[model samples]
Target: MDPGGRVNIFVDTFAWFTDPAHYTGSNAVQVRVFEHLELSALAVLIAAAIALPIGLYLGHTGRLAFIALNVANVGRALPSLALLAFALPIAFSLGLGLGFWPTLISLIPLALPPIMTNAYVGIRGVDRDVIEAARGMGLSEPGILRTVEAPLALPLILSGLRTASVNVVATATLGALVAGGGLGRYIVDGLALQEYDRLFAGALLVATLAILVEVAFGRFEARAVSPGLRSPADAL
Candidate 1:
């Protein structure tokens, strides 16, 4: 159509978002937005649960560093779309539920690399002199990890988690392609209907959510990091 036709369509879609009737109810965009938020949150939490400990262990042990780093690198290299495609058949064969589970599986591989790499770096980056001091004081391996290494490494580890969280939040949108419901449904539906306005709105909302989560977690990370690790001036 003409530019005027496109302009009118945009105006109408904008009006829909503002219209109370369209903003409320089971069918509303608002509901779908919340669903997206919930899905992203759950997936990130589960991913963190799996990634953090393994990352920490890999970092502390040093023996597994090569394997962990390689796995993470492979995760980074693999496309989520490809991963999801491979997971779908396995998921079906195992009788695991589709949609969210497969989506979650796809995301875990995507999320792990940053966490593992960061944890390894953070631990390895600790001041060797400090580590030596701790060992000189009779600290066991576990003791050194818990009291010295992990605390020192926390800020960096959190940085990695932050990166993973944001990536998962954005990638979760792909879930809609496989009938995994989220805000992505809006984008997919809008695309199918050739509704550019709705598609842009969905994309905008996803960007906003990602930024919000990153900012919120960043503050939490700053607060949660061990006091000893903070610079002397900043710690005060």
Candidate 2:
């Protein structure tokens, strides 16, 4: 084969996406990819459900703020792969099995920090005068939170969600380490077989997917923060 012909081999790996003979286009790949996406989404959603409320409470009360902030910091400091390795044994012990749940558990710590930090910062960043004005208008604490503070903080909170979502999507590739299933399967297998073309295909697919999700979430976030506001400053 000529140089160009040889290069074509690497490019042709993407054809596996449509090739029934390869795992990438087979049922196993479909099942694994879907499972990985579902697990990542579920973990992030759960983390958001828990983190947002706590963050808001800490931001508003100005109590336990340090604790919440430090927890997020520590979470960010921990390496994701190390956490995954650690969770593997624990998950097996708990009878959650060795595959999906353990991998999902590892991703939670990776996903939480951005959501919590952004939520806390967003709420706390709201103007004190606006908060006082809400109180002056006889708005209850919850009312202030719902109508005043949350509205102001919405943009920042969404920003955090956007960050968290992207992080989870990228990190979810590690799921394959535990046989939890994802595009990572191709990468690991490719490395084992010395198949650079297959590895490249997996990496390309992952990057493309991550970018697409990030862009989609960013648009959704923009809408969530402000239905009418088109610009960041206006949303804030």
Candidate 3:
């Protein structure tokens, strides 16, 4: 409300993080952090698995161009909280119970768009001249994709992974709203009990995790890009 109150929340958040009591139990900060990572990782992995193949195949063949481009748009059109809310009823009717499944399902969409779109765009963005060169060298369709296109597309594909990872990490906070675990628990419970420090601490943790993922992926993408493709089409 006031400047003093905001300052107090900051001070209290620092204290909350330093308190040993928050680090040793089932509900410890480390435990919640792990759960948060676990949920985010699984959702991203699943989304990638589903999106990558489809995106790559469509991009390689240059087929279904409309679907490839539009699917991500559709996913983005849906809100994360709305998706989570929509998932709850179906999860119950399917006997999946609460917590993990619904949250996981909702997070998958949050991750899907960037990954699928990037994969599609990256592959399509690969120099057509390169693809023709691969074909001229007697490389088959799969070989062209594996040896030429995918390698060239690596930086962008990894960019997608980076985006998806950060997104999932940030949005997985919604899991707590559905009785799931994670740092989000701190946010939800803190707000419920009017413990502003815990709320701030949770928000800080989510932001930190998201930033770490962004940095890690950025470095990995740099090292992971194909060396020859590092230059412009002039070399091609």
Best by TM-score: 3
Please identify model 2 stretches exceeding 4 Å from their true place.
1-6, 22-29, 227-236
Q: Is candidate 1 or candidate 3 better by lDDT?
A: 3
- CA RMSD, predictions in order: 2.5, 3.0, 2.2
Writing each residue's lDDT as its tens digit, candidate 2 over 1-236 gives: 49986677666776766667665444356665676578878889988988889888888888888877898878799988998998899899999997688888888888788898888898899889989998998999999999888888888888888788788888888877787777777787778798777776777777777788888887777667655435667646
- lDDT of candidate 3 over 119-226, digit per residue (tens): 889999998997998899899999998888888888889998899999899999999999999999999999999998999999999999999999999888777876
Q: Candidate 1, after superposition: displacement of residue 101 in Å?
A: 1.6
Please give each candidate's TM-score.
0.88, 0.88, 0.95
The candidate 2 region of ten consecutive residues with least summed lDDT is 23-32
User: What is candidate 3's TM-score against the reference?
Assistant: 0.95
lDDT of 1 by residue, 199-218 (tens): 77778778988999899988
Model 2 residue 134 distance off true place after TM-score fit, in angstroms? 0.8
Report, for every candidate in turn, its global Cα lDDT versus the true structure: 0.82, 0.80, 0.90
Task: Return the top candidate by lDDT.
Answer: 3
How many pairs in model 1 have backbone atoms within 3 A of each other, for residues 3 or more apart or on separate chains, i.e. clashes?
0
Which candidate, 1 or 3, would have the higher TM-score against the true structure? 3
